[model samples]
Target: MLLLICFYQDQTSLLSYTAAPSPHPSWPPAPGIKLCVFITRLTSRSFLTLSGHGYGVHCCCFSSCGSYLLSCSTDGSTMVWSSDTGEAAAVLQHPSRSALRVCAAAPDSSLLLAGACDGTVALWDFPSKTLRRCHPVSEASVVACCFSPCGQMFVTGCTYGDLKLWDVDMSLLYAQKDAHDLGVTCCSFAPLFQVDGCCVQLRLASCGQDNQLKIWIVSQREGTACTMKLLHTLTSQSAPILSCAFSSEGDLVVGGSVDKSVAIYDANLGTLLHILKQHDRYVTAVALSPTMPWIATGSMDRTVNVWRIGDGDSRTGRKLPGHSGLLLAYWSEVDVQTWLCEEGLEELVSIFKANNIGGAELSQLNKEAARELGIGLAESLGLRGRLLRKIKGLMAEQSGSEAPDEFLCPITRELMKDPVIAADGYSYERESIESWIRGKNKTSPMTNLPLQTSLLTPNRSLKMTITRWKSSQ
Candidate 1:
């Protein structure tokens, strides 16, 4: 479960990470908002889309200068999209496995990489329109990977706690087995902080299923690789640390958690500084921009939030529409309408029954009438059987109902059903609402972010404060 009020920020060109929380009285804390992976692009704009996948966009990154954008999927596909036109430049597909994570243009412009659940890192050659190659990682899936500043090397972390380094030639150099006691969900190489020439002395940060943040300094010596020691291990008060990233300063580490909160740490000491509790579900992604003063985050709540850092407490300020794709459900008085495209009355009837209304009531069909009333893309059936007439509208009289809308905005108190439409009259159909509930909406513990952080980071250091969205009265 994750949500970002906005994803208009980044780190490669480097301020990174965000969440909901308060800071120590004087440390100039980072602002926080709940929902994982504070999402942000270099530009403060994003297109709301809903037609491609049943799931929300997962991995998003920009080219070196923040020119081109790229994203991949759990549905086994990768899309390179033009930021200017919002059109797909290419779509790379996976076999049975889908990409779990993606690393955008390395310092080199010719290549891109995607980490897959199948324990393989898939590489792309921009010039050739084909999948260039794949390199096996480990028994477990690779969840996170990052490139070094020079683009000379890359590191991949597996869900089973292994971190492996690979040369550009795709040969293994260093493999740290059991990088975490539990699954390792994210990994990054410090940008400016370099090692004493063993390829690179990378500062590595990892978050995991173990509920702790682990940091290590790795370097190569005389053809032998060495790790300095565990720099720090910050244990959480609640759930495991799910996602983590570094700030441009190389001194801050931020992360999202399963506990429904956003946490900030002094990158050097692993000191917990701020926390954000503005979301009601697990935070999925977090992002921050070095040049910009704002932090944006997304969540399973289907909303993106923005905050200011520097206050020990998360000073929440804005919640924006994170998704633009609308699922316009057009309900009509007519009982028989088109929902899918296919032929055959009897077979289509059975198909809808099997797919849409699973385990729904079944009866000997009136074969002749079914042929007369097939549904289409432009039509909708009655919420229930129209034959029942006057008393049928009361849902309590029925056995059960459609899975109750997956989302309910705490602020607007409206059911986020499918098909949001601004109707001819001033009424809007439930498209945006439905997309939020079913698409991005998740059921993790992260949704429970703190609404107030006065007890945490106090008086006036509030970096960015979210305008308290009025909740349901």
Candidate 2:
């Protein structure tokens, strides 16, 4: 059974242009960064801290019904805690493993999987407090893990740039290895997928160092070994991708990156829908709250931030705080995107409009406007000859055109400090600079009257010009 409940974001993003006189723009940053935070120290209270890991929680997930909260740590221990009291319910430890990156419980709440720093996956029965199995992985660190919705299979993200799939029984080769440019950072297997005309099957979703998240379908071709086909490739968030997860509905995907925030995307279409920003640092971890319409994040800042889920408007999402160390995160999926060429194109269009950026010709328009402004200023000033030459040189030195751009005197090659009139017989006096400069124009040797020149030129006939230079002699 799926819930159709929609969590309406009651609060509007303050960064939204709605309040600004700038009028409504478009989607994407439809509102700017709302100047809002999901978690604030003054308002948020600690849930509970499971000591002994020597660090704060990195990743956390709930069972099928929100009965138990499973958490992993950088200190190399995975703990099962009661969702009610935040008390440590069970502690699972591996002596050799030093850091635990991710721990996820199966959708049915029967099994728990942990990806550790030592390149190994640890499976725990939970009820027996016994290790059901432990498998050695390659050199790439296990950055993420999750159980498919059906729990028939599990996958691990290893640094070797591949997603390794294993059957729950651990008997045969479920999936040998898959492709990614850098080490695979995270993997999620869609527990429920339709295959071969109405037959439900399992598929996998993965995120890695390449800054893209991919969807794979397991297909057994005749005369060829069973393989996961690269169904779709997505791009939106900038990398190194920190985390990715699916909403319970599974039609949507959320991911974070070194870019400092998370993005919402059409899962079926690899287009970006919205960008949410709040965390102080890179969003290293994220989790989706299916029932509550919330998404949680842990970052390098040692905090867990819970945000409103869906595209309700980033400003109003309720934020909750958790943890004490640099928060890394793990994520899971709810429903996988259905592959339909038409639907994919529609999604692409929607996301395209959502993150709408103007075309490349915008650069040309800016350049033209700047050129016009310079021409207008030049025509108004009525400057010519050496004066124009000096002004152009000064503008060149400034490098850019701005309202109050710097003007470097062409001869000095230094910024114009105190400009003065250069008419009349050469005269020097210790006096107020502006008044003295003005006095020179009031009376000139040519005519004991004000100069007709518009301060654009000076009568240098009797001027003593002292150009400074180093003499080789």
Candidate 3:
């Protein structure tokens, strides 16, 4: 059976589905498997079902920005759907017409890869929806694939117990034959890369039918030659692992197994951190939210469970107070009015309410926007001045101060709203670094040396810490 699960950045909605065989004759029938995807909004308690795959969907993944959802199926096609509208965006057919077992989208959403049962992998350009190339990477069925954080390379695993690394051009970089005693099931790369002088280090986790989970260190020196070495081998679970994923900051790794348990591990020490046993059947899929302390797992019993990772008690889940836990971008109109009242700007609440100003609009309000909105003229000059200062104070509260130095972005020197780790092993504000690179600067902001890659991985752990600090204040 096929199962998939995904979560929104705000924890507002969840995407999950189970598959059952359909009677349609458009394609050959696969016994006892399902053929549909479902998107569920937790707030509204609504469901949107996507039904295009002719057979069981083996895997599904959301794009980097969570705008699009991609799924691969035994029907020999990879389908893309708009996350907002639930409409099919494109249908990518496998060149060999073989059943696709897994699919992954690149970190930058520039390319997509789908692996087939015949060991053929089809690479498609994301923007144009056109096939770029198809290469046979293994002699056995290609069951697992994932792109590296740098977006310059990817790894693929097959039923032959082999793991191979390749560049974006599809050229093999390294191969580990017999990486697992049995077939490989899933693999994931850590979101951050460590830069040591001219060498870059990446951590990868892979699990297989041998009932073992292994971690490897893949090193690339001067962006040229590469080496792979096993660092840790974990056999905490009693059954074969079916899925695995790394947390956003690479601090933890999670795996789901046929034993109906989800295991979380400390990525650095490779020690078992938690074993969650809520599923009644084999756990088939697992995903860790990049922006929140939430874990989602899909099981063969046709259920998906979400678990929260806590600081004091990892086993206990707690809720944050007021607007402390919610992202400012997702604040509602009522939330904004409440904030205004708390800030002693209750006099202007009517005006803000009339303009339908929410958290997002509040964030963009400035002197010009305020004047355009008639706030500058309608209110007394002194009141306007207080309002402006309060807004600035809000920005400062969200950015830096009393916050840990590590939580501040290196470039902006402010508390980061969207933090990302660069190649130099430092986290920075996403907009600042993106603008820096967009201006044709290739040197590392912290090291003053040449950057190995332009890719940036989300610093989810740091962001969560900042959020907690804000809540405590």
Candidate 4:
């Protein structure tokens, strides 16, 4: 027989268990009263415990800047907490007077949304703490909600197994009926997107009571036409999946299941990477840190587990401290050699050095360039494939640094093709600033002061200047 004991303290919890002898007369009783005792001490990494909610908390999310935390509860209200301190900044009552089931903050931190049990969805201006819109989105209760990476649109999942996409004005743009078998439990949008001319492609993941996780490819064209298609369906978990999240880079997906297991998968390949079984009860919530290689999971057993992704080793097989923060566009021949060694292509280091392939030349290398370099240089197809993938990733990062700060939107941080001047006397991308204003923010995004007006004027001069800059490049 085994006996377990637990002790709770102000900051940590202590657990102890003991194993006693079997109670059988004929059982081999070797030695006198053999007993084994094990003592385990579990410490909490959490520094604060938010306790303002009167009922159970159904969902919680952090702001993009990590300054605020929003939690929805069954007490008919949503509470916003200061992430640095344990202070309840504000409490927002649900307009439906029903329990709030889920909440989501915009990627730009300009808007807040809360879904109620009565099928009501409320949008609030995050900066001004003012209600913007409250509408009934579905016949059944809304259980899941998330904002797109651009902050211009959001998706809501209901208990009726329906998924609806809405713009910032609460206008329904698209809807899919019976997305899941029973009901949609949770959904998340990837943090990155792909641009194909005038269309933007996004990846969305949703899990439900059907014991499955589905990934969908959502595309938005130049006009109002939008389309969605099923990309991948994952059935790694035996039980129903309760929660799902995407990594910062959108390369990995994690799901928590009612079977008390957490499964991590490759978002692109749709393959399972790892399964973690630590919680004794149903795992209800999962989140991946945007700045660190850590995952946090919450369970119905009232325990939260934090797991690190790697074993303290560098992700690229080896660490190169000298080239830690250096950009790929400025790497020298020696730096390229060091990177080759870090990526386990040390055998090709001599060849690359002989060719004098620096960062600038390496970033311009493609399949044709690789073939032109020589069949003997990159003879192995496997080696050439890995080198090209790494080079492509590096080139993408380099492109991000090529854009000038003046031509980039302050909110989205991307190069602006259509610049507009807001009432705050600052220029921003037309779409980005329009979304911020539509979110009901009366304050300026840069100065945080009340805006003179809500009107925006096209900045033709800035737009022409950006066009010239692009042409020169």
Candidate 5:
């Protein structure tokens, strides 16, 4: 979850404040021992590299039990490897497809979903060792996929900035929305909870190439389609966010950015909590340990830094040498937080109360104090201007600048400049459909059926209308 530690100049007296406990039964209880001593006793060297993917790895995740690691690569393959040995256990491919970019393992580890550069998602049933289905969900490449905790549904983020929700069978499209302008790079489904009677609450966090991180709440009405409503738009990052993950308890969001920094945010409050700039180059991927208060960050600098976290006494950066192309990182879950609560230094808890920082907003207030001591509050205040500009631009786009639904590309959700009628008797963006045919195969991106021809006929009437609309704007 979101672990808040308030560190003072002493460094030894690290105190932590805990948030409301998660209702998910799958989450393990927190650790019983203090973080500093517990982490110190663990092995210092924990880096392991899976060396089979021919191209750069893009995303990787640990299965719920931590027995296996699933990773997708630019090589167009998704491999299941033994987490302990780093040996490839199975390789998944459609023979015609490669360049798989993202993947997600079901919470029960019974199924796996792999997203490809061609925007197709492959659902695999591991027990039967069979390809269940290949779903063509978008024309632009699929960059991120996350399964719901209950395994009843999944969500995907596409390169064209579309976010879609699909049923467990990958048959029904429950909902769809345009989440970002340029492209949606990453998305994850937070653990669901029951709110009022018969009503469930679901939150989705997504980061995009547009340099925005958004939280959406998904709801459904009887006999109506599922809908996703934007809850918060977090835009404090000065660079594009490439990777994002929700804490096992769904209380925190950790993201890696192109600006050579890793940002940790409070999921409930949508506040940027900490920015760790340990890497020399762009931070491409980030993962939180399932069992401990640790965060693993993979960077373009060819280094994997395992950061030891504390309630109030976080350790300095520690870089570990590993894969030359470290694209993804993931950790298994455990109850480090509960352990600390039971056996941590009681004196530090009293210290936290004395400082008036023991309740909600403890993380935000403490992080701000830390920034005031380390850097100046000026930098933190400066982030607000950037965030405000992004929000204002978003508001303007949402109010009256929205294009007509027909003028938008079905795949990208953005305006379609070059509209063309495909063989499936549907109009699509020329570049989007052509890329799907050439990259994913000759199948229809919208129908996933064999097309009569790859050629696209220009939709002149729609194009003219789009042009006129843009001129009016």
Candidate 6:
């Protein structure tokens, strides 16, 4: 058995167990035990259920130091609590007694930003424990707020899909055009990183009901006005992406969706890295642990799941050996699949035996569901090829239906529509392989050897074969 252990802020232990000698079907086995990729092994995971909020929690943020946690809820109150002791540190009240829809703490933890239903953004002075300033951001309800790393300014997203920049003194700086077609649900500032002695790169990430994550790059000088530019536009297959966050280092991004999955990405490369399908309801909020290798996600189901960041290449679809029992349990029950869409894992698991679903008879259905769900999750996260092969193995019984290895792109596990041969004499999709060569990487993804040239030779033969195969299907 492989034993995976996790330690949280309060030294709570979460344990999971899996049998070893298993390898993800697509990946070759490395010596020793492997990490279980799915959110199974529920016995080993733990989370703190903060209860002071009388209603649903809209947001949860950890301080820069990760010593405290600030949670804002629809209960018209925002509370600061000790992450270690789970003790309430301070409670900030909204003047309108409206639900605090969003909240953020400055990097220094000296100030707090809370957005309420009354269309006002309140600034709270930390040490003084007093209302510092109350600024009306819009006539519509303010739904999202984030503090820049330096804490000089912050940004707010409203129900009207407007994004407004505000100064620490409650002055309006700049407002972007309607960032999303629909309501903006969440926004986060990338941790400010010093670019040089004189300037810093300030980036912001926001997501909304319109199914888009916009990365805004801010160009700022020491004393001059800052200019903002749209860096990248990430569109999701899931119609409404509810929450998004940047890693403490600002190099990674995570977003939660209404489809009950969390997507992780390489922020700089704009590559989808992993799709976490653990949640059973709309993920309402996501927060990264500044000090620990974990990502916390809160959902409409009223449960928080903290995922451990395993030291593995998330892009690779490495997983344990497949088992038919788990496969059937996942696929056979139409009710379980429905519950996976409508309820939490506990509810899904509880109804397993009661449904009278079991055995190898349901393997085909499970395989089909796995394929559809995996593809949908991957596409929703803008990770087209990232997860196609990892879950592909779940269709163990349908071995003959698997695509020929030569038809697959080496960089992305998905089948190639336009195959190409690089100077290294290896085949890959035209786009995937070219992206690797054109981007920061100059070496071949398959061989890791330096490419003599970035030129790619089209493989018309492989394209014909893929076309013929598709026609046969």
By lDDT, who's the top model here? Answer: 3
Query: For residues 1-473, what per-residue lDDT tens digits would candidate 4 score against the true structure?
Result: 11111111112211111111123222211211111111111123313445666544566666777677787865568878775554789999877556677899998899999987678899999988788989989888798999999999999998888888999999988898999988898999999999999999999999998889999999999985678899889887767788998998999999888776777889999976676655665666776656556566655454556565766343312121244234465577998999989888897788788899987788788877777766225457778888988888765543332345578776554578899999989999898778767754456655545778878999999999889888886
**Whole-model alpha-carbon lDDT for candidate 4:** 0.71
Top TM-score: which candidate number?
A: 3
On TM-score, who's better, 3 or 4?
A: 3
User: What ranges in model 6 sit over 4 Å off?
Assistant: 1-51, 301-473
Scored against the true structure, residue 113 in model 3 reaches a CA lDDT of 99
CA lDDT, every prediction? Answer: 0.50, 0.50, 0.75, 0.71, 0.62, 0.63
Could you tell me every candidate's TM-score relative to the true structure?
0.56, 0.57, 0.60, 0.57, 0.58, 0.55
- Which residue pairs show backbone clashes in model 2? 15-34, 16-31, 140-159, 149-191, 250-335, 285-329, 302-325
Instruction: State the lDDT at 350 in candidate 2.
Output: 31
Better of 4 and 5 by TM-score: 5
Which pairs of residues collide in candidate 4?
Answer: none
Error of 3 at 428 (Å): 53
* lDDT at 282, model 2: 56
lDDT by residue (11-86, candidate 3, tens digit) is 2212233222222222111212222246653323456777786545677887876778898875679999987777
Give the per-residue Cα lDDT of candidate 1 at 52: 43
Ten-residue stretch with the least lDDT total in model 5: 324-333
**What does the lDDT come to for candidate 3?**
0.75
The per-residue C-alpha lDDT of model 4 at residue 358 equals: 89
Error of 1 at 199 (Å): 6.8
Note the residue pairs that clash in candidate 6.
15-44, 24-319, 237-380
Better of 3 and 6 by lDDT: 3
